[model samples]
Target: MDWHTLGSTPFLPPLYWRAALKRKITGSTLPEQGLRCRVRINPNDVAAYRKVCGFADSPILPATYPHILAFGLQMQLLTAKDFPFPLLGLVHLSNRIRIHRPLGGVSELTIGVQACNLQPHSKGATFDLLTTAEDSLGLLWEAESRMLCRGVKLEGEALDNPLPTPTQVSELTRWKAPADIGRRYARVSGDYNPIHLSALTAKLFGFPQAIAHGLWNKAHTLAALGEHLPAANIELHVEFNKPVRLPSEVTLYCSAPGSSGELLLKGTGDLQHMVGKWQPIA
Candidate 1:
């Protein structure tokens, strides 16, 4: 889908604006309901996704990136002519994913997506979307993603505090990820978007080399938290500050005080920022 031209119109028509205002007061659920899509994981597709995401050649897929397929299905629903809302007006605010188990090889899975709650803000509007993916056995692989869309704004929010300030910088553990890591991750995750791996591919996107998947960094942060705290149920929030280049060492440092914990996962290279937050699972 050519996302570039999806919502070229700068202003919503007067009628559409009035409808949106009514939706803000009454709060409308996403128009698409009971929408479902399914796909069988293919080895070749997996290989491509792994290569793009920068994963090592292992039997199991990296815990993250399954959303690539899941979201693809959701996109189909969103872009349908009958679908509600204009795609271009949507802006990504935040996202969180939890992996129940490692996806090994190929398998069939089904994804269900629905829109919920249309919130109007001073800037424009916000829509809450939920997506769920599960295997044939009815076991949920992952659940719940919250996305925020900013309607129209003169200027986007500024980053006054771009740098993270951890109260305590603790000892860090380093991990050596292989160069072929991207290929392996892409294979399992089905996210062969081509920006994550290959220096040539990455150069087009202005990267020195293929960088590690954001989800992989998330997993590293979760692992670091597991080392210092119990992993029964932890709320993790990771902000993608910068990319971690391929074949590089990533150091994980964590600090926890009471129920709150802060984690800093940094790539030892030019792009030195990777930050995450952890709160005790409630």
Candidate 2:
């Protein structure tokens, strides 16, 4: 994973400029290299990280931090002599994850990541990458993340594009999310973002209530996938279409494969509100 060589492409063109404009509006970008890493999900670590993230108690690990292990491994990969790229300039444009299981205590986990296609943009270049994580028993807990990167521009105002209408994929699951889900997630993962806590905070952000953190949904989704899919060496891709409201009855709609195979998980609501997609990492 020579990030430097990977990102050394020169010359910006009109198409890239157009793509950059579109990304500015959509908040999308590509990351450098994606690779796997390992982490020990210790209960103590979860409790410590939770307090640091500002939760009153240890919430469940936010669904997203497992990918952080991927990122941590990525950093190590970048340090290899064969590795390329400067770490300072990269920025996280967007992130999406689907959890297949709930992380209860400390366990050894493996993460998989890969750099994807790069599209040019006015700011610089937009690169995409994928990441996945699994446990020792060969159970996949979660998968999928997309990231973007670009060079700084002089004008500072990158071009923006109109919002594309979201396509309705499928209805979300009908499982009832626990009332303490948000607090639990906040505690486990050290993310104290008020939007996942107080009603007033969510109201300020235009949410109906203090919605469940995205990572919580990811964790639960991973737990579910692990039940049916072959845990070892699995890959997945997911998109966040809509927010899951607190204490809501959500039904998970998943497309999974047989043991030693591939699968897709697309979720929707009873009212047919499309949530997102979960497929093997390409």
Candidate 3:
């Protein structure tokens, strides 16, 4: 397949100030040029991501690191010319990541992201963004991220994407996420979306207070899984049910493995703010 260097997303008035207008996202346009970029792995940043996610550094890149690296390009594609939905009101419904193999520190990568498959949800329209990263060898990693554009419900609205409910589950440890967690994570992952910065800045985006980055929560959950990971051929998935406002304590839990297992990052209440799982990608 042909690939090109990633470029700045085509800008329009809608993306510049999505928050200012409180506009309901309408339309369903897809990008003509999918997001593609060549990225050399930054050893320092990889180490930083590991540290933030509470992992001991190694030459092997964490499974979630590629997704972290590809996030910007994904956003650009979502906001590209004539994008159907506004960026501000969209909710990340879930993510499925497959780690085919480990990429060492010295690997040079080609990353591609494309928005695909918009479907209907009771509350809105949901779409999938597929992101993939590879080197000369073959496919290194890939992810399917589903996002919800609230208020743009298509015909035959489907069930809301809820957190996973597994029959056999266990409660893991709890951690108090500091108010500055978002910025702290941004330093590691380079995802500085303003809604995560602080209360005042987040207010501009309609969040009462700053919220934790969904990807950060995924990495944290994976880190907590520790040695439980399958020896090889791992695929991890997570659903973001609700936002975890900053300065909060949340619990982590997981379900018994039948096919894919479930991991829950829960606030004080029973609500699993985020749900995730991992299995061998057969």
Candidate 4:
């Protein structure tokens, strides 16, 4: 596969429009080309991300922070001319991140991203945007983000991996998701999906009001479990079940750190927003 080294991070807004206007390709295979960039981590940006995601101050990068570094490249891959799906209407179904070690005092990272694993879902087609972060030493972090394209059916049998069903559980803690969180996260993560921006834009896409980003909840969960996280070799998998509307109260249910367990985030009326788990990679 060919690797295209980006000189700088591609701006997201224009790519969305460009992908919307491009003619959709009709095939299963993604482009063989991939994207890579060398980024010097900005201390200010990292601090901003931690504050938004409720993480405590730390010299090491948060487990989910690499995704923010590679998001623009993922957007570029998804919006390429040969990509089979449109960029605007796709849904983030799930995310799986693996951290090999905590990165601190690392001035730069070589980030890479590519699209793969095209599969048929009952609702539509789904695919994975695989991303990696590395430095001169070796790979530090990697992730698989599954995305769904509604109304686009493929020929293969749809895979069935249902999200965990909501059950009554005691809340570990509650968090207030402010109305501007979507915009705040967007500023840090470069994901400006309209559904999460404002009630006005969200209503156009069938939501009553702006919703929080799925990964934001994932980040928050990790932040809450910060004490339990190991210094290296861990896996975090999260599935998006329902959208948490802006200006809403949400709760988290999870087993204490240093053990195996489920992590659930629910909004009002026991509406499940996310279900997930984390384990050490021994």
Candidate 5:
């Protein structure tokens, strides 16, 4: 918890771009943590984000959009020269988001992002980056993004997969996501990671071609599951396993509505793409 301050830094050369350029330019030692940043939401950007994420225009802000608002703050921590671990080759294991209230009424927010809780897995080392957004009303939203770092396995107990295996899943919806979906999401979310935008750029980082943003997968999945979500207080969590290749078709799946208020989405070859649970705040 070094608690580095991010004062008025521009959010250009996003996380992916910086990582691709600095994969081999890191220090032999570890980096510090607790980096923070803030921003005022622009009305125009919010509108564009809503369009890209399929959130209808309303006075109220979509629950997931706050993650997009925190993107710049996230990039700040990810690209910090002192930050440990190159952004390249880092796998997004899972994402958990909690919104205490709808933010459509709020116009400004203060974002704080911190990287903490580094633990080792059988396959690799894993960590969680926690980001919180606070407004005049107090902390309105918070999210925990989990990442896996391969080649950094440590001696410890094997990590148990919290997700249930999908057995009898039925397709809920299928659609072809265009090659440009990544770029579109990048523009709206300010996550212009090269791997998600271009094949040539992606090849630099070992991907055969460009891939969709994991957050985009979560957003679209949420849009599909909108009818089932509760109003106001909600928490959504998804673990990403495989990359959804560019210009590929996607089919969402589910088992049955359990008492847990969960909805599942699986990938081909039975790869676990995402498992989301939505519950109302009591």
Candidate 6:
């Protein structure tokens, strides 16, 4: 890969606009390059993230928070002219995160992002956006986010969906997801995808109404299970099954944290939005 290290994160809004233009240009293929940058955690930003995602106050950064640091790099890569897909329509299918140690005392982290694992999906093609974060000490966190570029077909067998259906779950908690949740999260996370911003913008992308950001729901679920999370060496995996429309009431359900670790978020009419679990890495 053509790797380039940057002194600061790239701005996302322009890149997003670039993506819109690139979508109209045909024959673009995934690039063979990656981006790396150094980032310092902001305590105030972490606090705001905690309040939005429902995490309890802690000096330690929540496991899901690091994705925010990696997002700009992700956008830069996806919006490049050589990237194969448009950022606006690609669906976030699954996210897998691994935390190797506590980040409470860490001040700066080196973050890297690359796209890989291009394969076929029944609906279209799928690929992985891999991100890593390391401190002066060593690698501390990483994640693999799978995205589906719908309606694209390729010359390979499609992989079966690996997310298992939930069974025998007990209600854990309910949340009223406000219509403005997308705007709130976008202000903090920098993922201003139109589908998640407002109903007017969402309809342009075929979504009947504004949809909540999948990572927001993922973070909220992790926060609910915060008491059971291990100090370090843990992995959290989640698959988005459906979108949670705006101004909706959703319920979190799981068999039990210690027993099964399986958790899911469902909206009105019992629409399953996400299924996930967290486990201590041995």
Clashes of each: 16, 42, 1, 0, 2, 0
Worst 10 residues of 5 by lDDT: 24-33
In angstroms, give how far residue 111 of model 5 lies from its true place.
0.6
lDDT of 5 by residue, 132-171 (tens): 8888888888889998777664666757577664556577
Order of quality (lDDT)? 6, 4, 3, 5, 1, 2
Q: lDDT winner between 1 and 3, please give it.
A: 3
* Residue 205 displacement in candidate 4 (angstroms): 1.3
Could you give me the TM-score of model 5 versus the true structure?
0.86
lDDT assessment of candidate 2: 0.47
Tens-place lDDT digits, model 3, residues 1-282? 234576542233444444344355547655555667777776777877887777666666777888877866766666554577767667877888888776564467888988878787777778888899888887888889898887875777486646546646698678777898899898886666779989998998788999998888887877777666763478888888778899898888886544467677889767668866777897
State model 6's lDDT: 0.86
Every candidate's lDDT:
0.54, 0.47, 0.75, 0.85, 0.73, 0.86
Worst 10 residues of 2 by lDDT: 2-11
Error of 4 at 39 (Å): 0.9
Residue ranges of candidate 2 with Cα displaced over 4 Å: 1-40, 43-65, 68-144, 147-173, 256-282
User: Which of the predicted structures, 1 or 5, would earn the higher TM-score when compared with the native?
Assistant: 5
**Could you give candidate 6's per-residue lDDT for residues 1-282 as a string of tens digits?**
889999899987788788777654244256789999999888888888888899999878888988999889998988877776877778899999988988688778999999998887898888899999999888899999999888777887997767786787788888988999999999889988889999999999898999999999998888887766675778888999989899899998886656237788988887989998777764
Clashing pairs in 4: none
Best-to-worst order by TM-score is: 6, 4, 3, 5, 1, 2
* C-alpha TM-scores of all predictions: 0.55, 0.47, 0.86, 0.93, 0.86, 0.95
Q: How does candidate 5 score on lDDT? A: 0.73
Which stretches in model 3 have alpha-carbon errors above 4 Å?
Answer: 1-4, 7-26, 159-163, 255-260
lDDT of 1: 0.54
- Per-residue error (Å), model 4, residue 229: 2.1
- Superposed on all Cα atoms, the candidates' RMSDs to the truth, in angstroms, are 10.1, 11.4, 3.5, 2.0, 3.0, 1.7
How do the residues 1-282 of candidate 1 rate in per-residue lDDT, one tens digit apiece?
Answer: 112222111222432333333322222345635456666666676566555544455565544545665655555445554455554334344345544444554376666666665555554655555666677556445534434444433234423233364658685677766676666665554334355668788777567788776665665555444446432244455666666678787777778544467767676653545665655544
Model 5 superposed RMSD (Cα): 3.0
